[model samples]
Target: MTATPVDTRPLAIDARGLVKRFDKTLAVDGVDIAIPEGAIYGILGPNGAGKTTTLRMLLGIIDPDAGTRSVLGASNPQDVARRIGYLPEERGLYPAMKCDEAIGFMGALRGLPLKVGKERGRELLEAHGLGHAIDKQIRQLSKGMAQTVQLLGTLVHRPKLVVFDEPFSGLDAINQGKLEVLIRGLADEGTTVIFSTHVIAHAERLCEGIAIIAGGKVPFTGPVDEARDRIPAQVRLETRSADGPWRAALPGDTRRVGNYWSFPLPETGVEPLLKALIDGDAGILSLSIERAGLHDAFVAIAGEAAARDMVTRGGGEAA
Candidate 1:
């Protein structure tokens, strides 16, 4: 008998058929997700798409009206809560508390020793260029600085899994870049990082996989590249000859702007078209093929209305 190879990779989060309703509103319907261990995953959608509700259910902060979920293999997330670090969408810290104290308090809530939490808090502050504000009152720091302190607190316990709900909402560009670096570092150290965001650019740049929710329903979920691949690669062509038989080979939807013609790559592939263009003596000055980005994929998979909502609400901020 031949021995079978076993797949050993573990799942950090597994959810199936999740549903939630508030009165007449169906917030989430039949949503399923599987996230692998140590992966950076993103929950992307427009505003009011139940992204927050889904996250809350996963963390056991709220129960799903229907379906099952497991976090770190536990059916009840609270049973393993100590192993998870969560940063809620709403940022909050006691105004009178010192920066280090606040971080320590957050860690202590998750079962870390106050002394150790404070020590780590100080170190984190120093590493992130907030050492000078370590003893300052929360009210004393700027809004951006306070938010950073709270985020550091979320990691003080060094949990195996970290979940951030709309973490970049109030951050400036520089801080946003720093946060991205921090997230990457955590993943490098074998921590599973999950975040919910309206910003498609962040997901495109950071996530290995993503789940796109629309109107409280999941439209698509899988690897970032897979989602992007739903749409064909775009082609940009610049030819010296404006008119020729080669034009017949171009896609019907091809559009011209000045000297450049742009369209989706033909299904028959570029080789046949290139031959036709050359044979017709249509001088090809510049030609390039570019993959469709997450933005385009979102519009294709989630519908134009959802894409419009994303932009009008907040998605345009990072685009």
Candidate 2:
């Protein structure tokens, strides 16, 4: 006999046309997202790309000028805030406070009793490998240990939704692994996790879906596999494998780099190119088709968006 797996798809976080403006500057310009329950959804962008601003707006730290965002079915930020555990990018912990004190304070802020907060604090410190440093002051702990304390504090209230902003920053490889495990455990326990970071590689392993924002707008928002599928899997054939007419016969965005050639492939239909290469018979040495990685996709999409922004601004300047 086997137990049935629970269905975990629900709208944990939903936003439509979210816009946040500060004076004349639009920090977040009309973003929309639907994040499923128990899923890790990553928001990725470069510096000053409005990732932090979007998160703040969603957490009710700052109100959006236009559009609506809901966390856990409550369109009102204040109402949903109590059910959310948030770790902001700019971390703050009182240097004089002990690890237990800090964690208890965070839990108390989330409406837990002092005794319960203290007990949970001890458990988290141990779980995160900070048990030895539990009584130590925040100032005395190492940066990685302090980070662990902060992460534990966020989870104290058992919130259904957790928002982590650059959660892996300032941690060693070991600590990063620890954090990844903890995050996965949270999602497994039925918590929806959303995080924003500039590091795309971290998100590649940590998130099932990702929303890539650039210049205050989302360019890609879907499952990681789906996003990867949108880009062509390219193969490089670096050989002196043709006569002068070979350039024209090559298929789909082929470029000659040094003595080698790079070709961006269209999905399917590689038979024509394969036949041409064999027919040309000009000494083919090595041919390899590399599946387009997330970095390649990010650079392609983000670069295009940036170029468009530049052209738009250039036109305005000329006018």
- Using TM-score as the measure, which candidate wins? 1
| lDDT of candidate 2 over 1-319, digit per residue (tens) | 2464544677887888889877777778898888988999898777667788888888888888888888888878778676889998778899999999999999888888878988899998887778898899999988888888888999898999999988877789988888888889999999999998767778888888888888888887877866776677777777665565445557656787777778777445567766666676746687787777776677777776553442243110100
lDDT of 1 at 193: 98
Q: For candidate 1, lDDT tens digit of each residue in 1-319?
A: 2454443569999999999998888889999999989999999998788898999999999999899999999999999999999998878999999989999999999999999999999999999999999999999999999999999999999999999999888799999999999999999999999999988999999999999999878889988988998998989999999998889989999999788999998888899989999999999999999999999999999998888887788532210
What are the RMSD figures for all models against the true structure?
Answer: 4.2, 6.5
- lDDT for model 2 comes to 0.80
lDDT of 1: 0.92
Worst 10 residues of 2 by lDDT: 310-319
